[model samples]
Target: MDGLSGQGPAAADRADTAIRAIGLIKDFGDTRAVDGVSLAVPRGTIYGLLGPNGAGKTTTLRMLLGIIDPSSGSRVVLGHDRPIDAAPQIGYLPEERGLYPAMHCREAIAFMGALRGLSLPEGRRRADALLAEHGLGEWARKPIRTLSKGMAQTVQLLGTIVHQPRLIVLDEPFSGLDAINQARLEEMIRTKAREGATVIFSTHVIAHAERLCERIAIIAKGKVAFEGAVDDARAKLRPIVRLRTRNADGPWRSAIPAGTRTSGRDWEFELPESGPEPLLRALIDGGAGIETLAIERPGLHDAFVAIAGDAAAAAMKQEVPQ
Candidate 1:
């Protein structure tokens, strides 16, 4: 089984969900950061919490990790009611970067593992192995300040998993990474999931979620705007049809859906509930010389815009790094 419906370790072993949250809410002073947000993450799968800046992604993650108490609601992590109870089994990389620049690369990783109850010797052994596996063996003794930004970030990530946690949570981990480093991180995430660890991450970058998430929850303005598999979200919107023909007007015009628009020799519109067959037949029967007809499925970005609305989606896009 994967871990979602069960309560304890035995039950979790019999189920497929690893983490489950119900009606989670967080309040600070007067502002409600998270409003009744609930989600279930399947065991051994990658789940994404997607939203724009200040959209409550981080707050929700924090609440789940037991880093902060929620104003209301409940959560189960690794089959335990208290996330802190399962601390040794969870690996987390917060949005903020905090590694001692004065510490050696291997010592830094070993220290992080040691905090999770790993013995110093064992932590150092694991750190050395991890650094070597990630192609940084030569720099294991060098200070963190001496490494490049990407290298430092890589070392920090290695530290996160040094103890081999069953669940990994990363918040905006891609921030400030170049394309190469981002790709490397994506590979690491996949590797963790493939090894039977449940992974949950929060990001404003829809592209990352779209590419890596098996299940995603789109949080907008402190609420869940949409949640499900990527394909299911896209299915909520109609497919688009693009037509290019010699005749843009006349009886052929009738074939275009009522809400569709036409410009010169090009036409574009959503496929109606009746399906594209009717429209195709209408165009052909009207004697319009068909030059090109293409149907395109809605992508995740399009689905995000549809569910989260233009304003929120635009804001998210703006917040994404260039």
Candidate 2:
């Protein structure tokens, strides 16, 4: 049942959405940071919130956590109507991670759990389990200041989830970790999703979105530029299959033979909606001496660049009004 509760037959529909925001708006004096943004995060999925810095990602997350009041609009986390009401059921790891560096790893993790409404002994028990799970048991007694960035990150992660919250909001959780730790973090995120906890994280790393999230929202210039299944977002950009040959000098470069265009390295482009067979046949008949062939499907990064770029261009045009 995903450990989430709601009421009535509508409960089923509501349970699917662990977090929902409608007409969410936050203003800082004259500047509108979040402008009428509506979002839904399905239960037990790792949803990625991606955007460039100052695109209102932080502001929006703060609103979700009830850290700051919205100028307008409303949000619901789990079944809670307000952020403070949801605090005990929600775990958050902020972008700017800070801890009592002087405190030992175990104590630090336990302390955070206590703040989340866990008892002292219960917090210590959860901390031990988490540290052991993260392969940091050996350093559990060491002061946080003595641990490396990766080690400390593992502790921070443990602290955030120790109370077994139903929803977690992590901001740049992988920012300082190395490749090994990043992989570990990814694994942990997956395990959380499997345990029926809805996980929403904000990250600049597109690879994380590609690897972990079932769906992603790319927020740009204070708005959601793209949101949906990863494959769907990629499909939005269309598909292009590229053919490369040792010989760049070929007739294929000129006259693309309809529905196709030459890119580089004897490459050809085609939209998936049209299928690939026609494009493949054209390249074969071109007699371009194909040494290698590859299909270039749109990726998350491509979609992000496309949407973010368009938003920036639009903003610029508005600024240049006569």
Candidate 3:
């Protein structure tokens, strides 16, 4: 709550932005799915939309992509005030997977590229090369129905990138990937960013956003709760100091804060705003022998739980993609 944000893009920022949404809202019948969300994603960077399921992450993405119109507000994608007009240069992979079951993996990838205007022959050549590079050469001729769920997902991801679009939008891309494949996907995102493509991905998984995003917007109750750099998110919570003492009980114990948690000889508490030096001096003057001292900053996971609340944390269940 300390760093809540929904900054609108300034006029001078338009030239460098890959996508800009100002007070986007969507309504399905009487239900308001998204409300007053604003974001400015810079070109050639990775941005993340993070939230629990049913938190309107998908709806916001859909409105931004021109797949659905916003009931209020507006979005601009790749210089097109009308997002659909810029469709040729944008690659989108929706949450639900759909592909022709009988099509061979190679042909399937090429077909996806063709839809984006890549010639079939050129698409096929690029597909083969991409498959080989990604350890899927042998699966090229296999039918989509024959591959396992993980393998099928990989094929779809390959297809998503075959055309090398200027902007790529992926919804819940890591939902079903195992550890290895997830790492591969992370690397692929980095590679795309290095090649100057702007990418936006939505996920409930905070780790992916922490690792890959240059900036992020955290959605809760269909609104932007927090948006900024990952480091900024983590800074909302104060760093904690963990201390170990040689003495079991001493006058120094009185110097500890009221909320300090103790375990055996260790004491942990948040570093006060006045700073840790005063506390350290107090403990030392009280004759406590400091065995170890550590100050640790909160990670994104901790900051997320702090900012989004316990309900959101429980909803994630710390799910590792299957």
Model 3, runs deviating above 4 Å: 1-11, 318-322
Badly placed stretches (over 4 Å) of model 1 are 1-14
Question: Per-residue CA lDDT of candidate 2, range 194-216, in tens?
Answer: 99999999877777888999988
Comparing 2 and 3 on lDDT, the stronger one: 3
Q: What shift in Å separates residue 59 of candidate 3 from its native position after superposition?
A: 0.7
Tell me the tens digit of each residue's lDDT in model 1 across 1-322.
3344535665754256788888999999999999999888989999999989999999999999999999999998987889999899999999998899999999999999998999999999999998888777998899999988888889899999999999999999999899999999999999999999999999999999989999999999899998778889999999999889987577877767787777888888998789878888888999788999999999999999999999998999898877
| C-alpha lDDT of all candidate models, in order | 0.90, 0.80, 0.91
On TM-score, the leading prediction is 3
RMSD of each: 2.8, 5.5, 4.8
Pairs in clash, predicted candidate 2: none
| Cα lDDT for residue 35, candidate 3 | 89
Sort by TM-score, best first: what order? Answer: 3, 1, 2
